[model samples]
Target chain A: MTVATFEASAPFHIPRWLAPFVVLSFAYIAVPFIGTNYLFEAILLPFLALSLAGVGLNILTGYAGQVSLGSAAFLAVGAFAAYNFNLRIEGLPLIGSIILSGFVAAAIGIVFGLPSLRLKGFYLAVSTLAAQFFVQWALTKFSWFSNDSASGVIDAPSLSIAGIAFNGAVGRYIFSLTIVSLLTFFAYRLVSSQTGRNFIAVRDNETAARIIGVPVLKTKLIAFAISSFIIGVAGVLWAFTYLRTVEPAGFNLDRSFQILFIIILGGLASIRGAFFGAALLVVSPLILSRLGSFLFGDLFNSGVLDMSQRIVLGALIILFLILEPDGLVSLWDRIRKRSVARLNKRKHVGRAAQPTQ
Target chain B: MSGFDWQFFVEVLIGGLLSGVMYSLVAIGFVLIYKTSGVLNFAQGAMLLFAALTFVSLVERGVPFALALIITFAVMVVIGIAIERVVLRPLTNRSPMTLFMATLGLSYILEGAAQLIWGTQVHGLDLGIDDVPFEVGGVLISQFDLFAAAIAAALVLFLSVFFRYTRVGLAFRAVADDQFAALAVGLRLPRIWATVWAVAGLVALVAGLLWGARLGVQFSLSLVVLKALPVLVLGGFDSIPGAIVGGLLIGATEKLAEVYIGEYFGGGTESWFAYVVALAFLLIRPSGIFGQKLVERV
Candidate 1:
């Protein structure tokens, strides 16, 4: 594929990438207006929330070269913290509660990230499992997190901002879309910035990064902070917008693996890849179940269907690792490159004919 | 609070030590695969579940206990070889992260396959050991615990001797020490890997039987491996003895904490206390006790 270089003197010209993204953004905004309620609630809201979590994980694991298996812990922390902040503090707006929850999750993330300074590879990953189990335990053990609910489940308070209630599926979808878009925009800028370069350097080689004047420890911690902040917000969206009722059990080890799979399947370290991974994770099982029922009628029981889903998911992960480790984004890139090559060949032929004339 | 009951403490310690041997059994499987192939085999838990489920299901169908055990062992050996051929072989020379993820994928496949083959209902696995507690020196101990410990000891002894005396054992050690050197010496990497996986699978079966006897063969039987993570971290991932000693320590500490410290946190701290202990230990000694010092060259 050829790199598109913009002239330094060019003023106020949008990049070619922005054209497709702009159209996509408009369609995203129009979804609530044009699409069915089931499409908005059953599909898009959860996808957006999980996509944001995938983006957060991609920053730390993909860009910074850290493998964490405790992302669900941060999600749980974010959700519970937001719930507590909203419940205890009177008259505090939902936005403040959400941002506060993000900060809280970031702080905890930095604390857990400290072990990364000494541990590397699978060792660090195992240590992160401590956070996963510990967070889950804490949330369940203490009734304070769940507001002392008998069932240990907490309901999200109605979301409203500046006298406008974002309560229904449409409102929640728009709210989640706005939050995801803004966070994704920030993530794009962060990945391209000097700090982001430091993250890449640290991930590629910590010793080399340090020798070349990159602050390795700080870079790692910052990656954790930013990633957790985004993930925490995703957690808030997961609780308040998508599920609407939160339980600690919902954010289990499996959930963490699911998010990790999203980044892996979507294309690690790419912002667009997070969304792709989330969409696939959310939509594929539904499609697979539908196809399974249609194909086999009553022969395919739910238990068998569930088992098949897991087998398919596992096979897909292995296949992606073997065939395209860079994931679907790389596949898309290859296709685009081939088409671009063909277009350039046609253009060159046309120029040759014109010169002959 | 009634001045610490010494007898109760001793009882808890003894019970914890016995169960720790069970954890060690699972941890040994991890060490074997990791030592040979450098893969952290997260599927060890799933293997344990599959082994136990198969054995129990066979026994349920009126297969004698001994026959069921033999058949399960054969099935596990086939699985070990199949996994090595299909998954590990293709993904050789990848980063540890990639290998780790493959094991994670392997785990999902194993879990799903286990449930699909043997329905998800919980099953009772009786190894014929009586569960009645016997008193010795004012501390009560379960007869089953003693049996489990004996089995664990025998397994460890057999493994140590096997690794020390046999020709294949020498090849295994050589491969574990340096894969490239082993390859230069014409040792077939695939054969060694298949052997190590088979050994690990055998270890998982023993662990599964013991744990299944204690807790019943259920979906949660697989989750016992989570408790073994602390044992691996504390003992050092690559050391066999480390797994044993680490397992004992985690088991004792977990019981003691659950009995004493759990009250402050409203009980049930055993679920995560081991992980916290392991995390703290990692902060102090990143390589873990008895683990070879990792020397990184830039």
Candidate 2:
């Protein structure tokens, strides 16, 4: 469909209820600058980086339908590559370094992704795990990646846009927000394009997609490349602006699995679900811990129950997958429709039920 | 020192075979579970650790080693039955991907629960058997390794007999081959599934004991089963014999790599050497040595 026709035919224009929500979210995202230094450093920046990583993964697993269990390895590639570029290039622009890191990550992702051409389903998962071990091993063993640091850790160089340093919490937060927002806008556009449709089509049915002229191999590889590139950039920001110093263990299987859980919890196919899922994975545990403390005082403390937290979380993931495979985004959609129906019911009586059907 | 030391080669080969037997024990548990449920039980390693911990603790608390081993096997049977009833039964007819995720979750739960029940500290397990290395024709070998290898061979032999000769075993293979067809012919699907899980648990208990005896019982003991994964990939997911052969191949190569190739890389190559073996096999024959090639009906 032409862009003009698509705009004209679109149903359910942005509702009044959602319009306020959008504006409020934007303000909340911007208003975090007023918080204390610890809150920004300890909370918001890491959360943003993790959420961006979640979005990058959702594009691959959720949209492209390739299950990746080694996303952390890609993130590590980005962070370490960006570090090397910044150190070696001498007068290299920061933006150029960040973009180059993504390209490096994409190259590594493709190398690991080659097995996917022959493997599928659970077999593919096991294969991806090799990437996790191999990359982590390299990071730990090859001291050059960490610049021969004593502890095998890399420290992010200070960020500068043409020598205007973003050194403080406020400056870093603004820089991260602008980059994440821009990347998110581009992701949204990409997901709606022909390439995106082809990915979803292949995901839904590879055979059917191939029959209909979708280049299966090219589409899958492109999805992997794009996904890794975005995740790599996020990793660069994660290290440079968020963590400041990173060890190999920080980007292991746990982070990859956590990101998978987030995307799955949010909604598989929806782009906006990335934030919802990231919020759950990142913030829900903290919220749950606080709630647990309030309810149980000192007896059933969060730390003691931390191990149990995994059991419960595992249970919840299975429960959500079984009961509501469409995830929290679908639940949100359902609630909005119901409320709209309830209001119309008072005005039109019996007509509301039919419209819902 | 000498041209082609015959005794050293024999010694390394024997050692490799012994370690391979232990790996096969774990892979066999994996094969049994995969055959019946069509789910790769990632928790097999964790189950091994849990079983080993339970066995050692019971023995440490004054139960005889023999009694502890038997009691642990029985407990495994019960645990297997519970898993089939509580976890697998509820999610019957879900997609394979969902089942895979559920198993992954189960692994986390099992690992955590094992740690909580048995403190995270490593404990030395004494099997009441001599571990001293003995020599035959100038080739020194540990009796513990030989005994473990013997036990593995005997277990596989018994399973082979049980599956091929017994009525219950026949039911298992029938169910594995075609669940719907077996059901159509008046077979009880749930009963067969329960039985298969019980057998898997029994194998896990034995595997756990031997592994713990060698490595010492700890939470990380579960990672050794990861060594079995490459075995599964190389042997094909469903082949029992493949598990045995794959295990041996991995065991020999891992040791050789650590001793030979690891010198160039400053050692620690054993941590991931087996995966490299599995990856190479996957690149060559993705279906595995004994696994049936998947023909997707497009």
DockQ of each: 0.57, 0.46
B1-298 in candidate 1: lDDT tens per residue?
7698999999999999988988999999999998988888899999999999999999999999899999999999999999999899989998878988988888888888999889889999888888999999889998998998899999999998999999999999999999999999999999999999999999999999999998999888888879888899888889999999999999999999998888999888887899888878878898888787771211
Over all chains combined, what TM-score does candidate 1 have? 0.96
Clashing pairs in 1: none
Pairs with backbone N, CA or C atoms under 3 Å apart (clashes), candidate 2: none
Off by over 4 Å in 1: A1-14, A17-20, A346-357, B295-298
The CAPRI quality class of candidate 1 comes to medium
Interface RMSD of each: 2.4, 2.8
Candidate 2's C-alpha runs over 4 A off are: A1-30, A33-39, A291-303, A346-354, B1-10, B295-298
For model 2, how does the per-residue alpha-carbon lDDT over A68-132 read when each residue is reduced to its tens digit?
A: 88899888999999999999998889899999999999998888788777777666677777787
DockQ of 2: 0.46
Model 2: how far residue B194 lies from native, Å? 2.6
